[model samples]
Target chain A: MAAPMKSVGSKLSVERPAFTTTSFQKKTRSKLVSIPGTRPSVQNGQLIVSTGVTSLDYLLGGGLAVGTLLLIEEDRYDSYSRMILKYFLAEGVVCRHELFVAAVQESPDDILQELPAPILDDIAIHKPVEQHGLPCGPQDSLDSMKIAWRYQNLPKVQSALASSSRFGHYYDVSKTMEPEIRQAANCHRFYFPEHPTQSSPTQSPMLESYSALLKSLQEVIHKGGFDGAAPMTKSRNILRIGLHSLGSALWGDDLCCRDNPRHSHALTTFLYGLRALLRSSLSVAVVTLPSHLIQNRALMGSITRLCDNAISLESFKGSERETNPLYKDYHGLLHVRQVPHLNCLVSELPDRKDLAFKLKRKQFSIERLHLPPDLSETVSRVSRGELAGAAMPGSACGSSTSGNKHLDF
Target chain B: MFTELNSILNITPDNFKQGEFVLISDRHTDGSFLIHHFLSFYLRARCKVCFLGLVQSFSHYCAVSQRLGVSLVQAKEKGQLIFLEGLKESLSVLIPKEPNTGSQALDFLRDPSAGLRSLYEFVRASVSHTGGVEGVEGVEGGVEEWGPPVLLVDDLSVLLSLGVSVGAALDFSHYCRATVCSQLQGSMVMLVRCEAEEEEDDGDEEGPERLLKGLTHQCSLTLQVQGLPTGYCRDIHGQVEVCWRNRHGNGQQMQKKLFQYKVHDKSASFFARGTSSAVL
Candidate 1:
């Protein structure tokens, strides 16, 4: 009644406040019938895995809406979130698609086993690991794709994004191309309504055009968008964009997590901008700051709102997965709790929900939710510079982009 | 993955309350049997009810529910046992919401014989077809009640001895919006008997001699209900005093009681190592 949990067409609705233009999209166009339960719009976008079951789409109001940002928030990493993400792997890999996982505090294997199909052919994973070295930024996304696409004078886009240890899997590319990674740049997708407008103080058209074009072009090439447009490009039909722990990435490689606000804010802005860039009907996913999300509940509400019409996944094997709330809200987005029969500690692709968990104190209490915006003005009245309810978990504080970027990355 | 974490995934009344049945089983053999009897009675009473035992129980329940057109969620593996297959799934549209709503289970039970047949048919059909509960065909197919009156069972002999009380348990069932039953046409009360291997005297149950046979042997079961207080309790060397077996073999009220003190003992301490549970 108060509007369903997801605001699917809200972006389009907001973008075109005056009229509903039908010709704008190649296929998708809507008047937005807001019913108690709205069925998700379905299209054969990139034909990924079918989740093996049809019921989850019903709860999702429809299957995982393509090109949507999934914000998995749990008090701790748990099975539900992990399973949900693995379901995507099954989707991406089995369907000849690819998944880019962004977990700053977990190891890839720790979560991969929870999925049903362990050998994820379509999954290009990125999980943080202290013991084992792994990419920690958008730079990684860039370097790997280049390596995957431009290997030994041939298009090896897939290998560039894939781990070198997996070179054996791609004997053709591994034999000729350089195994070393070229560079890594952290980013997901960007909403480019206006082409890198010079009007916005924060935006630089050159950087915007290069970054936006490069990221999308990688997928477009993966979509075979570059076969005729550019020579020496062979990647097509699969893409996974991961902004793994963008918040932490924003903090300098040296400073502790608590010390960098401006950096964090910029990272948040970059992510939101990417959401805007996703436009409509392009399938993509991003996983980031799960624990941070749970810790900053109030801020996450706005973040979740930003990721409207999205699916949230939990890393079941993460240290704190058991206590997270995402396990409950997403309705076991992964099926981790059912792994015993399969006789695997790690479930395989198609896990979309973790086990059930009850919180001693719900991160977002009723009172903290549905608060008015004037709280920010109240905070301003008393403080130097804090947004309304900035301290509150719902204030969307965790990823606030501090307009400070005079320094170097 | 099976972490040693003891977390929960599903609670009885979840966000989407289509239908849920939680089984709280006590390890004691007698207690478990008694609880199972009551549970079976409820499962029989409500077409929407399901009995989930162990692993096999989950599969059986899911299959049965599928047959009955009732949506059931069961996790197929051990690591994520708490995760159910269909709990978070949304198939309500597939299941009819208004399958001929009569508004009253009693008002429709006016025609006694047809009412009972319709109730059974409704259940059997649901178990057999996708839209069985809709009662489009077969028994339990009619909703026009033939004066189905509500009866409350109040005999202590049945409630205390077996550690089961159809009369007590039915209180929850009383909340049913509609029911299928012809024998219970005008009366809301029904007789429930414990299942056992009985030596039939080659006589129909319709004879008075059957009732006179009394109890042949005391049941070997003690019901241990958690979170329930024990009344009429006695202190035995090994048995829980709150509820115990009636020692008389031929007595109508016969039962089995477990004899053991929960000594500072690690007897079945194997399970104490704890199991994985989802907390989110």
Candidate 2:
């Protein structure tokens, strides 16, 4: 084992340490793991796992730190949230990490089948090497070829390297997930079926209570080797926990159901317990709650406060944005309500906090929104020579022909 | 075509950032004209646009684009313009015919869940075809790549009339907003029709009002379109009230401004109401 030496005078003195070289190396070095598509950030010596979506990882300041609880408030449709959950799970699968899916509505098998396939770019990486030979022709002299060789060795933009290393994969929604990979992945699924009416208060419950579910989840997580007590393995695997549609009608009653204080209390207790679990273990939990169902703003506020990060989706189809000519190309709006504070040393902090998101077939992106252009400027531009050609035809021809005809009639 | 409207909204192609959700609402049913005008603006600016026509037919939209001097066919050929047949699908659902009874067909037509899902699927397919998300990895030879495409929905209110629940419709809109406006770094424009008066007695108006409220709260910018009285002025076509809360501005306070617009043969102009005639 190679040991790091401390210099004594001009010569290096090989001082025998109390511990073994391997143990010393392990103690000194920070454990860093890479999550696909996102830059790995070290927080208190542990590597933060990537959220799977590159853009999202960028937004969250180099992916979510380990032991962080990310709360996603489900938008009206719940599709976007579901899509995000899939990306998270897919990322876990790709990294050979363990996943715990706490689903309330859909079965785990159905959800797994809908996972997006890993986008492979083997062709993209090989294309550049092939093209590198194209510039040198058979007719080229040795001197010219020598010059080309010199230029080729010069550092090119590292975008190709960057693209090749990107961990995010685009899953085709039309195709189902590959069963071989799905079976190979270490995924634990717990389905919490809703029980609308119970026969008796004293009788054994048909469905697991929120507290029982939280305890069972904790028990599973502890058994998954994420408790941080075991010796660091060469292959560090992250534990991803996803709670789909929490606080929805499927989860007993709505979180804001004041009439059922018992249910609401249980949910609050579960959230607190989940946060505690996240803080102690080498795991990340993504809990999605339907914002619309929780009418009580105070309760919503408390729930959001418990999580490290919170993002809510609001879909507005009102007349204001829908009818405006200026907004003719826009779809819906997105608001980044909260961002978790990172304690790590970051090179460049994400500047844009508030953003609007758009969903395409395979990709989702977030962008900083800007106000529409002033009306007076447009009118002025038309009057100026900028739009002179466009304005002349309308004013000179339309007035002369249509206005005169209208006046004549 | 959009100069007047763009000016009123304080947005120009150069300054308009990608991934903004702009809602255009018309009290009068002239939003189609505005949608056409904006599409022309995008096309003129050399921006790729995906038009989801939920209310108007694709041919009609194309004709309007042509009339506005936008080369729709060329744009389509160049992959700069894409049209999602939302209206066609919605019509198909409305006019379903099979061995099933009339009542059964009617029930299917009125089922908002299926219609909303199909609409969402149609939009996803169109966005994907345009290389919205999944195509980022495949960069070939040094050919000029298309920038993120702007998504334009003709009208979202049509989903409400198609028997979809307000919540589901709002959810779809939210999903679109989260995806197209936030994730794709693409601009999105959705048209919604607002009733001129609040009919408290009518239950039908309540859904639209709720939708309007929800959308208004989320949009960064909102332009209220209203047709001007016929005899008010020969030059002025209509009035638009622009309301927006500057995302970067202090305190998230909403700003409201009004402009009278005149749509001439080729160009449109927006002037401060008092100076409308003089500007024209």
Candidate 3:
């Protein structure tokens, strides 16, 4: 009966098939997750994670891209770079992301156990008062009204809370990490050279190689199901890989000291593979190297090239410039030699090119520098008086005669 | 004069960029006063700051900052300021009842790498939440926007005294620079003492001197502070020679300028040395 009714006017012919429109319409959904302090940015419809420091995310133009490798050239102190690595791993733990820590010098367990505890509680209690200044004046209330008005109309400032809440957590180094949180963290530690060598081997082939380490990392990443297409229902998790002191002797051999072609080749190959692995998956790796150890510039350059970002730290303690007054408050100097554009979608770039770092009891900060306040006015005043006196030495000497006359009376 | 200083440096939200390193060179004893000036400036600007007291105790720095007009206690309570006790770590070994014996303390002092590592970890954890989202939920209307964080290391030369090798110290400096430049997006002001190297050292060539040279080469900007020659000017405390290269512009051109500064009990002022002063 339905076919007979449609035969008169051919309703079926006029009606479009449901699949036709559905197939042509693109179902593009962008899922962006916030890393605590960074602006919410997406790359190819995926979210980027925070570097665990807001200022750093701002410097990075929006935190490290979802899948990129970050290489840090360690300062002689090595503590600062290691601290950064700790922040990376600690953040990973906080975000419930998978962490892979490869340590050459220290035990990975000790490093993990020593991971800083998040200062979320302190932040929660103090941030509101600190941010708004305790609603002291009528002007503040008036400003609040204006902000309310702005919040409704301005998209940039509308979701202030939403944006603020998306910031990373600060940790307390004095406090030990909670057992539950530490246990819940999806972390894997790889300590290179399972067994210590009793004596120096000219070429210990049995010792773990960079290639082997890379292979194991790849396998771990793959096994964790972080590779390939992300699930449709949830966003992809971030995978943080930390390579602590790569050029150090802990990673099989000191690539800096050894001229052996094999050692260099292994490092270069491992870096290449690691970079490739990072690109193909949703992961970020941070490698710390002591540039001082790497005597070969060409070798260091090559290593830097393999990574997406390269940063160098130099302390001024023994430098001729260390006596420079402007550096009086700094712990060290920092140079952002290179930052790769892994994602084409990000438009903002890091504002600073060179920075100084100061390490305090609780925090580390980098700042763009300007010449310290100029005191030319004071100098000029003094100099003007001196010049006037010098130009009229006779007059200056005679002027004292008048004062002496009064004293003589 | 405070406002004038602030304007000259332009350490405001608009001009101050995160990830900058500032090297402050001075006689070890004198720089602390100069550093207090910066601490007050940042704190006044509502910046979260961490002061690593390697040379002085936390209480001492706090007192100094307080005199400079920054209420360290209030700032600390607001979680906007933190004072890390670096001196304690090394001095702890000297305590009679402490677990670390004199030998261990000597060993720790001789090898500052371990202490530096722990200090680094502490700092990383302290500022991790800066601009973070954790406790922002209950914050009501009109949240004040804060400038980037600030870190002040009292004196870097302590590491040298602690027997941190020249290479290792240089490496540490490099690591600090990289960390701040790449991860913190904040500002660091490090104080280094420009003590004349002793002539008696035989094996190493003026270790501190060499280290200073290396740091100067790596730094973008170097400012050297020298006390006014004995009674050159009673009003002037010191002179600062600023050498900087604009990293953004050509990067080749280096600029040098000199400023004279006077420090009072609670305030400091800087003046450009007029040409007349040089002639005199």
On residues A142-188, what C-alpha lDDT tens digit does candidate 2 reach at each position? 43455456564444331111222344454444455688988898888
Worst 10 residues of 3 chain A by lDDT: A1-10
TM-score of each: 0.26, 0.43, 0.44
Tens-place lDDT per residue, model 3, B61-156, is 554555466678777756677776554443323222334443332233423444455456556666566554312322463334455667777766
Candidate 1 C-alpha lDDT tens digits along A160-215: 01112221111111121121210121123333333343332322211333344335
Candidate DockQ scores, in order: 0.01, 0.01, 0.01
Candidate 2 CAPRI classification by DockQ: incorrect
lDDT of each: 0.28, 0.59, 0.59
TM-score result, candidate 3: 0.44
Candidate 3 falls in which docking quality class? incorrect
Interface quality of candidate 2 as DockQ: 0.01
Compared with the real two-chain complex, what DockQ does model 1 have?
A: 0.01
TM-score of chain A of each: 0.37, 0.66, 0.68
Ranking by TM-score: 3, 2, 1
